[model samples]
Structure formats: C-alpha cells, structure tokens
Target: MSRLTRTGQNVLTEAMMRIAVLGGTGLMGKLVVTAARDAGHDVVIAARSTGVDISTGMGMDAAFDGVDAVVDVSDHVTNNAKKAVAFFESAAENIAKAERKAGVKHHVLLSIVNCDDPRLKAFGYYQGKAAQERAVEASGIPFTILRSTQWFEFGEKTVSVMGFGPVALVPRMLSRPVAAKTVARSLLNCVEQGPSGRAADLAGPEDLEIPAMTRTILQRRGQRKLLIPISVPGAGKAMRSGALLPGPGSMSAGPTLEEWLSAR
Candidate 1:
C-alpha cells in the first residue's frame, strides 16, 4: 500500500485519524471540537458530560481508544497553589498515561503565551500550565503546544464574574486578546499539521485595554454598567503592560473588537 501523502509541514501519521478533545464541553473546547469536525476529522468530546474525568483518570482510556491525537484544555478554577498543582499533575499524568497506552501519535496542549514565565502575576495558574506543558513536552508522543493570547470571551466573562447588582467592574490592564473562535480555528489548523513542537503564539487582531474591552461589551449589549476602573497589582500589571501581547512574528489575525461585539 502506498504510504499516506504528507499534508504539509506537520508530522502526520499515514492513517485515518480520530481526535479526542480533553475539555470538549467548555467554551474553548466547544470551539475546538466544532473546528475539528468542520475540518472533516473524526472528533471525540472527552469531558465530565461525556463520562470522562481527566482530573481523576476516570474513563480516560476508553475515551482515548483509537484516538490518534488529543487536545488538552482542561482547567482547574482556583487560587490555591496546592490544589492547582494537584489538579494539573493528575490531569496531565492521566492524559499522558492514557495517550501513551493508546499509542496516540500526537498530543496538543493549549497554553498561555507567557505561562512559561515564572514571574507572571497569575503565577499559580501559570505554574500549573507550565507544569502541564512540561508533561506534554516530556511525553514520548509527538506533541504540539499552542501558546495563545487571552481571549475576548475570557475578558467578557471576567467582567460578568464581577457582578455589581447590574454594573460590571472592569479592571484596567493591557491585552492583545483574540476571539475564542479564532483560537479554536488556529488550534484546528495546528491539529491538521499534527505536532510542530511549539507553534507560533496566537494573539488578537489588535491591542486593547481591559477597560476598553469591557466598555465595548457593555455598549454592545445595550446594558448600562458602571465601568469602574480599578488598579490591580502583579499579574494585572503584567497584563496591563502588554505582557500578554505576542512578541514579534506572533499570530494576530483574529476578528477586531468592533467585530467581536457586533457578533455577540
């Protein structure tokens, strides 16, 4: 039989492929799964609703069966270092173990652009992400680590979380944030390319301030809210100072803020 033809620069196996997404239920996961399906690859959703607990290794092997690639985007929402460490270690260990047993050819992990920096303000989560990236990098499987910028959806959700009876308190920070859908599309492109070690960092179409993003969301939603700009320290400063913006040559071709708001 003729070996399958190379698609492009990525290391792709010569066989029909099935891709399993580790956190296929959340916003970003949903976008990844959809993009994968739209790209004509077989897709699997591995999440709590799908009978898989990546954090505890429950039902992981079964979910990984016949899967040639896995995209891990699972998150443990907390501020505690110990809990973050434990969750990340277990989730990374379980996913890596299951993929190893399944002989998965490619592993994909979505991470922040500056997570490798120990000095970032969100150090706890950054530590977890950095450790997770290390696990993927060390695993025997060929892997692609996609380091992307902050998503506009996240910026919006952050505002939503700071509920003030109807008013949203916006933080003042700097970001070169992309849309979640755009990130999802880039992930799919990388998935098709298999694993390129580390793909270029993905950023937003334009640089934006945190307060401006929040105000745009509010204005677009037609909701009047107190756009309270408060001074946040540490990680907040890092973000406000454009720490999240991609360095030279980073990917930055997502929808603009005006486009993002109009679509919502």
Candidate 2:
C-alpha cells in the first residue's frame, strides 16, 4: 500500500521498501541514506567505504541482492573532459550491469540541469554527465533522472578551489542554486515513487550569479577575500547567458541563498 506525500509542490505516493544508495557516503548520498532510513525504508550504503565500489563494480552484486531501487548520486570531480567522461561512463556501465543481475526495479540518477546544451559543450563535466545519461538510456533499465541546478553549498566548494592568497577567481556564471538538503529529499521521493523517465528540474527560488553567491558565503564565514569573476571563453560565456539556470517548467524550492547562509 502507498500513501500520498509531498516534497514541495509535487504530489507523490510512497511505500516503504529496501533501497541501495551508490556513493552513499558522499554529500548527496549521505543525505539520501539518512532520509530513506528515517522514512522507514531499509537503506544500503553501496560505496567504497562499505566494500561496494560502483566505479569498478566490486561487491555490487551482493550489495544489491534484494534492493528494490538504487539511487546513484556518485560524482566525478574534474574539469578535463577526458577524465570526467572516463569516470562517469565506466561507473554507469558498472551500475547497469549490477542492477541487471540483481533485477533492481528502479535506477535513480542525479544529474545537472541543461548539461546537454550545446553551449555547455566545452565544459568537460557536463560532457561526462551527458555521457552518463546516454549510458543509462541504453542500459535497458527503468530509470529516473533528476537534473538539478548547482547547490547552495557549492559556493563554499568553489571558494576552496578557486581562492588564492587574497582573491578568489570564480567563473562568471548564472545559476539558480537549490539547497543540498532539498535535492536529497527530492531524490528519495523519486526512489519511493519509482521510475519516471525525467523528473522536473529542481532549482532554488531566485536566480543568482556565482561571484555574488561566493561573496555572500565569504562574508558569512567572516573571511576577507577579494572575489574576481572572470569569463571563460566557452562554458563561462554560456553560463553567463543563463545556460545553467532552470526553465519555466522546472520545480522551484527554498531556502533562498540568503536563508541558506544564515542557517549555516
């Protein structure tokens, strides 16, 4: 039996069942794991820490033995197209193989919004994401792909990598960043409801620029640093044009940027 539940505006019905989360120890995965368990579902953590390596398909078969669904929140952090493509494609293939053998009913994948836009072609990370989508489509498994905008927490992540001694040079990009917690909840909702080819794109309430978002985070953290937003030739220019922002049909959720910072 299923009951109606809401995760923002969408009305979904959920049932308790066992589910496996690949990369379950990572940021998004950890959130999904906790949420699913709290909701009365058996949650399996399929990650290297748990001996199930999705990248190499190690221990995947046994880990997914009786799992009803699998939420793949695995990520490959790289700016190089080649490395990103290699990691995502291999991981997707491995996941497909394991799920096939285990007869996992649903495959939920977390992805980025507008990753396949021609304007984002130069962005290696997007390219790899696109490849993963294709691999899933060809995998012959029932799946749900949740494409989301950058998360609010990404501001802090960017600051860490882009900061120099006194200044942080971030890409000049437009975005509608959602809270990571919001995204995690949405993913679990997807898991409970079963496969829907492409779920609505999830984004924050307001559109924002990357540099300004980072500046706000820096101010909140009490870190003094000059932020310089530079336009990269291809991906940067595309993002500045709002290539990464959500469309009209996308589902919007909260804690706005300011709200997210205040709570942190």
Candidate 3:
C-alpha cells in the first residue's frame, strides 16, 4: 500500500518506503535518517557500525529484505585515486546487487557538484566520485543522483588539511558552501519524491572565495595564522577556475556562509 506525505509544496504519494540509509550514522546520514523517520517511514541504518557493510556485501541481503529504497550517503574519505575508485565501485556494486535481489525501487546517491568536469580529474577524490556515479548509473535499480557543492563544515577542515606550521596554504578557489542541514533536507525530499534520474544541482546562497572562508574559520577559532593563498596547478586550478561552482538555474539553499558562521 502506498502512502502520501507533504514536502514543501509537493505531496509525495509513494508507498511508505522502508528506506535503508547506507552510512546512516555519519553526519549527513544521520540527518537523512531523522528526516525519513519523522516522515513516518521505516528507516534502516546500514553502516560498518551497524553490521551492514556495503563494500563487502556482508549482511546486506537481510538488510535489504523489505526495504523499498536505498539512500547511499556512504563515503570513503581519501585523496588517492586508486583507493577512492576501489571503495566507491565496490560499495556501489554490492548495494546494487543487494537492491536488485531485494526488489528495491529507488537508489539515491549523494555526490559532489562538478565531479564530472575533466578539469577536476587531477584530484583522486573527484575521480573516485566520478567512478561512483558511473557505477550507480549502470546499476539496474532506478536511481536519483543529488550533486551538491561544498559544505560549511568543509571550510574548517580545509584549514586543518592545508595548514603548515604558522601558515595555512589556502587555495585560490571559489565555492558555494551549502549547509549540511539544507543538504539533508534536500536528500529526504528526493527520497520521498522517488527517483528523478539526474536532479537539479544543489548549492549555497552565495559564491565565496576559499581563502576568505579559511580566514573566517581562523577568526572564529581565535587563531592567528597567515593564510597563504596559492593557485594549485592541476586540480586546484580547476577548482579555482569555477569548475566546482553550480551551473545556472541550480537550486540554492540556506543558510548563507556569513549567517551560518555568525550563529556558530
């Protein structure tokens, strides 16, 4: 029996799906789970901590038993091309096979914006994401791919990853940093709306400079560090060249970086 629910102006009439969220304990995954459960759907947490490993297919058959949809927010944080490719490909394949067997209807994927740009291929992580998108496309299950821009949380992490001694090596890149909460809401909307193939790109309210964002982070943390802005040669260049920015007519959401930072 199908169920009906309201999301913004749209009323979703899809069945009350038993949605299995891969990496359901992670940052974004947690939000997705909460949203699904709040909407009166059965939410299954699939993660390494939950004993459902998507990469190896262990315990997946049982997990997918009555699941109507699978939202894959699982992620492997790596910059190595080979490792990133291996993880996403393996996980996608395993999930697709399990979903096929379980007769799941929708497979929702969370990916980065501009991941398919040739200019960004120099970065191993982007390469892995591209491969992950490919793997999902080839999967027989009907799917929806939500490509989003960088998150506000990523700003702080960039400072840590690029910091050197007394200085932070900030890239001369532009980004529209969306709130993870906004992203979570969007993903849940997709889940309720069912599969839409390639949906419109999601982004933040304003275009921001990477170095300025890092500086804001330093100020917020009360750290006095020299932010050395540099143009990266390959992948960095692509990022700075606006390859990571969302295209025209993309869906933009709050809170803006300034507003988000001020509240934090």
Candidate 4:
C-alpha cells in the first residue's frame, strides 16, 4: 500500500515530531525539511550556513540542544579522495559525540545505495559513507539508515560540470534518477517511525534509464545538445548493473515519473 494513501491525521499525529536535518540547505535537505514540516514535525535546519559544522564540531553543542533526532544529509563537494574521507569520518565522529552529550535518540541518514560494493564505489565517497554508517552503528544510539538511488538533480548538475570545447558529455554512467522529493518523503517516514537500524532502501516508482532522463531534460531546455554516454570503467559498471535500485517491498507507492512531471 502507498504511504500517502495511509496518511491522515492519525499518521500526522505520529509523524509530527522534532527532527533535525544536518544539511538542510542542500537539494535533498531542502525537500526533507519541507516535507517534514508539512507532515507537522518541528524541523531544525543545521549546516555551516546555519552555524553547525558537524566535521569540526563548531556550534554543535548549541545546535543539537533539545533535538529529538538527527537526519544527516550533509555532503562535501570534492572529487579528492582524502578530503572525502576526512569530511565523513570526522563528521560521523562529531555527530556521535554531540548526540551523546545531548542525549538525542535517533540519528537517521540518506546514504547512497551499494555503498559497500567496492566495484561501484568512487575513491572515498562510498568509503566515507561506509565509515559514517559504521560510526553511528557503533555509537549504540537508535539509528535508521536509508540507502537511496541517485537524484534527478544530480543528472542536471553532471551536465553542467563539463566544458569540453562547447560540447557537454555525460559520464557513461548509470542511475535510477529518482526525484529528490520522493527520497525526502521516504526518509521522513523513517524518521517518524523512530529508529529501525537501517530501514529498507528507497527508489523511484519507475526505473528511469539515465540516458533517457538526460535526453528528456536536454529537450525540455530547448538545447539541441549532443550528449555522449561513455561507459566508465569501474564504479560505472556497478551502477549500470542496478546496484542502486531498491530491494523488494522497499519503495513507497508514489507518483510515477509522468505523474510527477505533470504535477511539477
């Protein structure tokens, strides 16, 4: 059954609780904050911009004050492997430290799917995420870990990351390309459920081929763009194998791609 169909005053009364989003300013964070607030939860937006840097522990003592649970969607923008490791490991340790001090109960997160699959992981991005999950699991606080598919916005961002002599090329990578809002809503449900210690992974209602989604966006933008899909060597292969797709009974019944686009 669809979660939305089951939602009502009863669900809201249960789901409406204090929840903090670590990277509330980011794309996924934005949707989570809005969705949680719409569901009647007391929401706190924590980020460097909001005076909370989890990695350095600056402003954390004050930021987590009275926070019921923490949803960490924070990310560092870096292709450098060492930096990724530092950010995630440090941030995980700090979150555990501050939460221990504050006595916060649950620490939820939106982690990438197949994070443990070595072949699909990029340098330290997956490794860092794995480290973070391990830290939280070892912390003994009730936690809910959600592995999610790639975001639709990621495709948009990937397209802009190229400057190959007036031509843009997509990494011959594969993705499920679920909407950010869908991911947000699913994570919120887990938050309201308290802590499940790694809940079921979530994906979109439809399986969208990355190349097709990219082409659709390009067409919508009125750019007669040439998108070259390159079969990347390592992690790319894992992604193509559907490592990020959700498992059975893991997805919420939500609007399909056409329905979502129409509503937007």
Candidate 5:
C-alpha cells in the first residue's frame, strides 16, 4: 500500500509521476501545475504557447515523451454549438493520438457536470463537451473524466462579457459554484488515484441563481448594474430549474462565493 499525508487541503502521495498538462497556461491548468509540483510530481506543460498545439496535433510527440499520465484542461469559451463542438472534438482527437504515441498510462479530463442532460442538447457548449467525452471514450486509452459545476470565478467572467455599463443580461440559471483552486486540487487528486472512468461529480456547497451571483460579484467590484434575466430555448430553460445541479452522490465542498471572494 502507498503512504499518503495531508498538506493543507491537498493530499500528497508518496508515488510521484511525470505528468503532462495540456492547456497548462489557463486558470485551472496553472493551478494544477502548481499543486502537482507542490506535491513533488514532475510536470510538462503542453500548450500552443509552449509549441504543443492540440488543434492540429503539432509538437505533441516531444511534449509527452516519458510522461506517465496526461491531464487535459483545454477549453474554448463559446456559445456557438457548432464552433464549440468542432474545437473540443478536434482537441480530443489530437490529444488521444498523442497519448497513444507516448504510451501514456492515464488520461484525465476536466469537464462540466450535467453536460449530457437531454435538455442541454441545444446548448452549443454542452453539445461540444459531450462530443469530446465520446471521443475520449473511444480513444482506447485508460481515462478518467471528472465533471464539475461552474467555478465561482464564472460570475466574474459572465459579468465581464455580458455587462454593458450599468446593465447586464445575466443568464437565468442555477449553479453550485466551487472555487477554481478547489477544483484544481480535486483534479490532481483524481490523477493520483489513477483512471476510474467517470469519477463522482464535484460541486460547491450552496445552490445559487446565476443572476443573483453575478449581481453580488458586480457589487463586490463596486459596479451597480441593472440585472436582467434572459432565457434561452433549450439548455437555458433547463438550467433555471436545476438541470445543471449535481445528482445524488456528488462531492460538494466549499469556501462559498462570498468566502472565496474574501480570500481573494
């Protein structure tokens, strides 16, 4: 049996592995790199900025050389379903090929919870995510997919993109938002545990309205805005009624939205 010890909120394992982090420059990606390094694991960052592009499969062979496992945190932010599907599918296919080439043992993907609900089929982003999941499953590689709820920072990102001076059209949806750092720690924990396919969903402690959360975020930034709740036909309608919420047996933890903001 392997020995384990607690370090703050993270569990450090005695068996360290050489890990390759795809999209290692993004918010979650950077956190994973830090956590892995802090836990004494060697990390290789595979990203376009580092000359490893997953889109066209360039520069991946060298990046995965001797990598014991691969963690994919690649993301494309878009509401256009076709575009989102294309991006994720391409990324998945390329990453799968590279993993096979490098003979990597384990593959981990960070995805969204409830992304495959029939109600969300019309939502382009979720549709894209579903496609990516299917690709990963068919890749013939040992893999684990950890689906998580939206992060607390999502409120800030929504406000930034949807805000128009004193008015913001926030999505009419519900979410259990966890901290991005917390999610990062969970991903690395999954990495150490090895491949287990479709790990338990990860969520935050509180159930919240998207618009209300965004409003609070705006207030924290000293911006008072007229928040209007807008609904879409399919996925948007589902989200308002908790379609995005985790099902039974999800792992819900927190530093809630307020607590996370205070810490920042």
Candidate 6:
C-alpha cells in the first residue's frame, strides 16, 4: 500500500514507494530505475549483473524485502521457442512466488504489443511474452501489463542482426518506434497508479516502414549496405503485414523515430 496522508486542506499526500526493478541494468530497466528514483521512490535493482537471477529465483527474496511493487522488464535474448518459453515462464513464476511472499502490492510487466495476436503465435518471442502474461495474471497478485510497440533501437538492432556481408535483409514491416524513455515514463505511471490489469497499449507518434527505418539507420551510421526487402514466412509475414501495430484504446507518446534519431 502506498503511504498516503491527508493534509489540512484535505489533499492526500503521496507517499514514497520502494520499487524493485527486475532487469534494472538493461537498457529500458536502467531508465525505469532512474525515473523511479527521480520521482523520489526507492529502487531495488534486481538483475543477473546485480547478483539476482529471476529465472532461477536466486537472490529474489532479499530483493523483494519491503518492496511495494515489482516492475519486471527482464528479457531473455533468444528467438528459439523452447528457450524463450522456458525462460519467461521460469522468470515470471519466480517473481510471482517471491512477490506473494513479500506481500507486494503491485506487479507490473512490460510486454510487447500484439503479443497475443494470432498472427504472432508462431513467433517464439511473442509466445514467450504471451505465456509470461498468463503467468502474471494467475499469480494471485494485483498486476498491470503495459504492452509497448517496438522501440526506436529496434531499427538498428534489426539491421545488425540481419546484415550479411554487404547486404542487409529486411522484411517489409510497419512499426511505430517509441523512445525507450517514453516507455519508461509510462511504466512509472503504471507503478504510481497501482495495478489496473492490462493497461492500454503504448505506441509512438508516427508509423514507419521497417526497410525505411533500416535505411535511415544505415545512412545515419554512414554504413553503405545494400538493402534487400525480403518477404518473411510464417510469423515474420504477419509482422510484415502490420499485425504488431497497436489497436484502439492505446496511449500514444512522442519522440518519434525521426526525433529520437535526431537527438541521438
């Protein structure tokens, strides 16, 4: 429970919360920690680098001590179905178990938009995210899920992953790339507002094609690589078909890809 006190003017005073960030050392996790701290909340960074492993449940007990909320931004970097599923399931279960014991009030998860879409069923990563959401839902803890579209960094990461020799293979995909900082702010909002169970999806201000994003990345980096637009099969095809875009009732933020790139 948040520490709130009513003042003489009948205005409630917001109490400082102690937030535990599961993937605190990672890109988005770091921003979340900073944002929480900047907002006068105490933050506990729980990550492998910080001597806590969520998948194995090691070091979680101490980290959750007196924690008001658990923000799980932990990520497993694998596209393999079995591995992704195993990792997310294990991590979510561990976090839930620990949170229950700690009597934490809120459980916040950062997931991908459209992860539950049928089109992404064949994608291992999306499957893992879906499974994670289910685990959190059944955890017996009050929870909120913030699903966000692809990050601006995804552009460069996709190019690097698909680059082969002088050519970069990219699927014809449409994505609204939001800035990580913007997403962090939204996560903090979820934390402050407590659990609302499946909050509105979060997306960027503008939608752009993947190949064009890749080209912009390459150009900005001064890398002259031939860009090949390839049609991906299965789930990749769904991704290219714009199934990942946020649906109605989503929350939109700024620092669009172009704006983010300019700032970078």
User: Against the unseen true structure, what C-alpha lDDT does each candidate score?
Assistant: 0.80, 0.90, 0.88, 0.77, 0.89, 0.89
Ranking by lDDT: 2, 5, 6, 3, 1, 4
Model 4: per-residue Cα lDDT over 84-115, one tens digit each: 77788788888989988988989998888767
Over 127-235, each residue of candidate 3 has an lDDT whose tens digit, in order, gives: 8999999999999789999999988877667678888878878777899989888898899899888899988999999998878887887798798989888876578
Error of 1 at 187 (Å): 0.8
Q: How far is 213's C-alpha from truth in model 6 (Å)?
A: 1.0
As for TM-score, the candidate ahead, 4 or 6, is: 6
Q: How well is each residue in 87-194 modelled by candidate 5, as lDDT tens digits?
A: 999888888898899999999999999888898888888988988999899899999999999888887787778889877787888989889999999999989999
Worst 10 residues of 2 by lDDT: 1-10
Per-prediction CA RMSD (Å) = 4.0, 3.4, 3.0, 4.0, 3.0, 3.2
- In terms of lDDT, which candidate is stronger, 4 or 6? 6
lDDT agreement of model 4 with the native: 0.77
Q: What total of clashing residue pairs does each candidate reach?
A: 2, 0, 0, 1, 1, 0
> Looking at model 6, which ten-residue stretch has the lowest summed lDDT?
1-10
Candidate that beats the other on lDDT, 1 or 5, i.e. the better one: 5
lDDT score for candidate 1 against the true structure: 0.80
Candidate 5: C-alpha lDDT: 0.89
TM-score of each: 0.89, 0.92, 0.88, 0.87, 0.92, 0.90
Which of the predicted structures, 2 or 4, would earn the higher lDDT when compared with the native? 2
lDDT of 1 by residue, 167-207 (tens): 77776767788899998888877777878998999988888
The weakest ten consecutive residues by lDDT in model 1 span 1-10
Error of 1 at 143 (Å): 0.7
Model 1 regions more than 4 Å off:
1-16, 231-233
Q: Of 3 and 5, which scores higher on TM-score?
A: 5
Question: Which is better, 5 or 6, measured by lDDT?
Answer: 5
Give candidate 3 misplaced runs (Cα > 4 Å): 1-15, 160-169, 221-226, 230-233
